[model samples]
Each structure stands twice: as C-alpha cells, then as structure tokens.
Target: MGLTAGVLAIDAGNSKTDVAVVAPDGTVLATARGEGFRPPAVGLDTAMAALAATVARALAAAGAPAVAHVSACLANADLPVEEQQLTEALETRGTTVEVRNDTFAVLRAGVTEPRGVAVVCGAGINCVGMHPDGRTARFPALGRISGDWGGGWALAEEALWYAARAQDGRGAPTALARALPAHFGLPDMPALIEALHLRRVPSSRRHELTPVLFATAADGDPVARAIVDRQADEVVTMATVALTRLGLLDERTPVLLGGSVLAAGHPRLVDRVRALLADRAPRAVPRIVTAAPVLGAALLGLDRLAAPPESHHRLRAHFGT
Candidate 1:
C-alpha cells in the first residue's frame, strides 16, 4: 500500500476513544476523540460502532478513503476471546485489523525496546510485560476480585474508608476526616457519608476525591500518606512480579508507568516507587509516559507497515511529549 493509503490507529479506553490516521512515513494525517467503548454493557456491535464514529471522523479529517491497516488498543479486551471478537469487529471497518489490551499501548509508548513492563494506574490498575523472545506476562486486572489494588478510585475509596473509621473512633485521627467531606462542600463526615450512601453525591464522583487525597498527602496527612505509600507499593509489587515472571529481573528492564495517577508526577508516589524498585528490582528503570497512548496505537500501525526507526521518530516528534 502507498503512504497515501495510510493506517488507522485507535486507542479505545473505558472512558474515551482516540483515533488517528498516519501515513507510512509516520506523518500524522488526522486525529479524533470520542466516547468510550462499552462492549460488556452494550454488546460488541454497539461498542464497535462507538469506536467507528471516531474512526470516520479521523478518516474524514485526513481525507483518506480507506486505511491499509488498523491497530487498536482497547480497554475491557482482557481475554483472548474478547480480543478476537474485537479484532473481527474492527476488521469490518478496515482492511487489516489488530487489537490488544490498552495496557499494551502504554507499554509500547514508554519502552522503545521490545522487552519491558508497564503498569497503568488510571480509574483502575493493570500490569503487562513483554520479553524480547516474544514472551508476555499480564494480570487479569479485573479490579478487587482479581487481587489488584492502587488506582484513582481505590485511593479515593481508601481515603473515605479511613475518614469514616476515624470519625467513629475506629481508626487513627487524620485530616481526611475533615478533608474528604470538605471536598464535597459538605458540613461534616456524617453528611458526606449520608450523601454518598443516598447517591446524592453519586459514587461515580468518588474519583474526584483522588486529587484531594494526593493533596492531603502532600501536606503530610498521615492517613492520606499511608494510602499514597500503599499505591507506590502496589506499583512496585506489580512491576516486580511482571519483571520476575518475564525473567527480566537481572536485565536492565524498562518499567513504564502510565495513566493519570502515575503520570501526575506526585512526589509521594514517584519517590516511593523509585525507592522500592531500587530495593526490589535493582536493574529496573522506571519511566512515566508523557505521551498519549494513541501515539502508541499509531506507532503500531507504522510497525505493521514495516516503517523504519526514522518513521517512529517522526511520529513521536509530531505527537510531541
């Protein structure tokens, strides 16, 4: 296919979708964002259509007819069956289609090398690793039931739990007792608790409290600091297990961190992650991905086209850090 034919790249997360069109030489042709995919809730057809809307917009923006390939990194595509299902669905929209978990997007975005591990801490947490020999390691990442911990929602919930307990004298005193309710403009913990239980404040808004927890930790709130510490521990624990599983513990492995929680560069989190990784996996180098993961999807498209390193450079430069 010619460069003008281009490749369609899609990064579909639980909360949003980003689509891009890139030529064979890594020139970004078009980019668009749209609603998230909800395959489990709305079925595969609806989910694919949601993603296709963005793809169409990108194609229109670039004035391209049909892409030569499609590289998609999607959220909720945990199982092989799910990936295959999505791959089949996406192939209908393009000539050639590839689909993988969104964490792979983060992994590829941060590590230029083929071998590395990536942990994403957004609304939820997930870890995945790749070996140069084509081996891979990944967690199920189905949230609490899957033995996962330390994401924005988890952090906010931890803060609320501690604050509620502290209010009833079941836990140690902390600023969260006041800060958590105050964040919602409530008078006291009781009001905050009541509103949360009644859905007056809505549990979905719980994620909004994550920044409050981080800010309180920054001010030396012991309980909030403890949550941050646990988050750091979880990040390192996931990375350690992934690196060990892939047998990259002794190798100079790149440990890539992504998503809003880790990407925020909070000292309380990053500093502790650095310290823990130094002790546990001394050879692992931690790096926070500054680029959007859609770039990773685009790069995968270029890779499928067998574009060279210079093409990768041009894509990165066009996408920016």
Candidate 2:
C-alpha cells in the first residue's frame, strides 16, 4: 500500500457533476463541481473536457502530483457498453478508471454494510441492488418508455399534462392550471402553452412546477393528487423490484431511498410509498440516507486500490460517518 496514494472520485448526475480528491486516510484534499455529463445536456466530448477540467482543479488544490486511481459513478451508465465508453473517456486523462452506474455509489454511501437495495429518483429514476454473494439486478429505467414513470421529469410532465387537460375541460379541474402559469408569470393556460411553443420556457426549467403539483395535491386537487399517488406507487414498485431481485423481500431487509424527490421530505409521498412498500414487501423497511454520493465514489476508489485494512478503516472513519 502506498502511504502517499491519492484517489480521484467523480459523481456525474443528471443535473451536475461533483469531483473530489482524497488521501489514503480519507481526508478530502479538494473538490470541484461541474455541469451534467448525461447526453443532450452535455455531449461526450464536452463531458470529457469538463471532467478533465474539474479533476485538474481538484488535483491542484490538493497539491497532488497525480492520482493513482479514479472511480466514476455516473447516471445513464447502467449498460456495460456505456460504462466502457465512460471509462475510456476518463482514462484518456492518464489514470486507471473504473465506472459504474450512479445508483451503486449511492447504495455504497447509504448502506452501512455492502448488501441492500437503493432507489434513486432524480431527473430520472432507477433501482439497483447488490447481494453479498455477488448477485446483482437493476430495474430498467426506460424513461417514459415501457410505461415507466417517476422522477423530476415524470412529475413535471404529469403536471403539464394535467394542466393542459384541465384547460380543455377533459380532466378533473385542478389548481395546477392556475398555479403553473403563475410560476411563469403567465396569466392563463393559453399563454403558458404559447410560451412553451415559442421555446420561451425551457424543458428543464419546467421541473420547477413539480412542487406545485404536490402543493395542489395537498389542497385537494383531484388531478394533482392522482399524479402524486401514481408517482409514489411507481417509486414503491421500483424499490420492490430491487428488493425482490436481491432476495431481500423475505424479512429484515433494509432498503434506502435517495434522490431529489425522496429527499424533498414530502410527507404525503413518503407516507404513500411507505404504505405501498409495506403492503407489497412486508419485511422491508425503508431508511433515509443523508450521506452524500461523493463519499460513495471515494469508497469505490479506495476499494479499487485494495488498500490495507487500517487504511480502509481510516478512510471509512473519516468519510463514511
């Protein structure tokens, strides 16, 4: 084991990328944040360039001559081919790199031990689990296809669809029609539609209306409540699939929830998901994870080094808790 060894960890999410450099002892030497690496938001060339820039900045701040290893946990990296592409891109910067889906990193960061299920609902939704004996399964996150639903994008789309329906009197009346336009300072639904058509309103920014959906549901809007309830059910379904695949559905299995939607602390959504999970998987209990994803990426980097026992202990003590 090299006492002076350093690791570079990168967590590339849908909305942002976070990079960190850490010593063998787990003390973070430096950190940097950059734009999203997912396609459409950032092309392969731009994403690699941004990764290099962030890594260079962190290394300079850490005063490290070079990093010995890199572990990147990225969104949209579920397939082996995607992982290979991302790993190749990072290796061009001159370090041995390992790549895995972002949810694995979240699971590592949130789970005290190594075996359990993790459900992430950020801009997109995914569920993943790893067993103690190396078995693994990941639920497909087909993004609006395969009847998949959940995540910020799902919520936003639901809200907009409801608002448009309510405007046309084809759906149950809801406050979303009023509230959504107010979000953009538009006086009515027609103007909101016009703004969307004119490209005055960006698709990503439409996610901001998700909160209004929850609020409308709270205030007894039938359409909004239906959307929220359906989303909660979808999340529970994803979590259940992961638990089942891991054989953790029997009893005493722990499931951790992470991502923007779950972390938002929406009581109704939380309660609905808890109810659904309990009904479907009687033995599973969902836990809250407050650990940052960067820590998970760092743990993966350390694991790759096959660091000494004492080094692992020190790293976890410094960053895991």
Taking every candidate in turn, the Cα RMSD to the unseen true structure, in Å, is 1.8, 2.5
Extract clashing residue pairs from model 2.
none
The numbered model that scores best in lDDT is 1
lDDT of 2 by residue, 1-321 (tens): 223346888888877888888776667888888877765456878777876787778777777757888888888786788889888888854368888898888887876556788888777788888787778778657676655788888898889888988899998788899999999999988899888888898765888988888888889888888888988888788878888877888957767788988888688888988899889988887876667788888887877776665655665676657
Model 1: per-residue lDDT, tens digit, 217-251? 99999889999999999999999999999999999
Tell me the whole-model lDDT of each prediction, alpha carbons only.
0.89, 0.80
Off by over 4 Å in 1: 1-4
Q: Candidate 2, TM-score vs. the true structure? A: 0.91
Worst 10 residues of 2 by lDDT: 1-10
lDDT of 2 at 168: 90
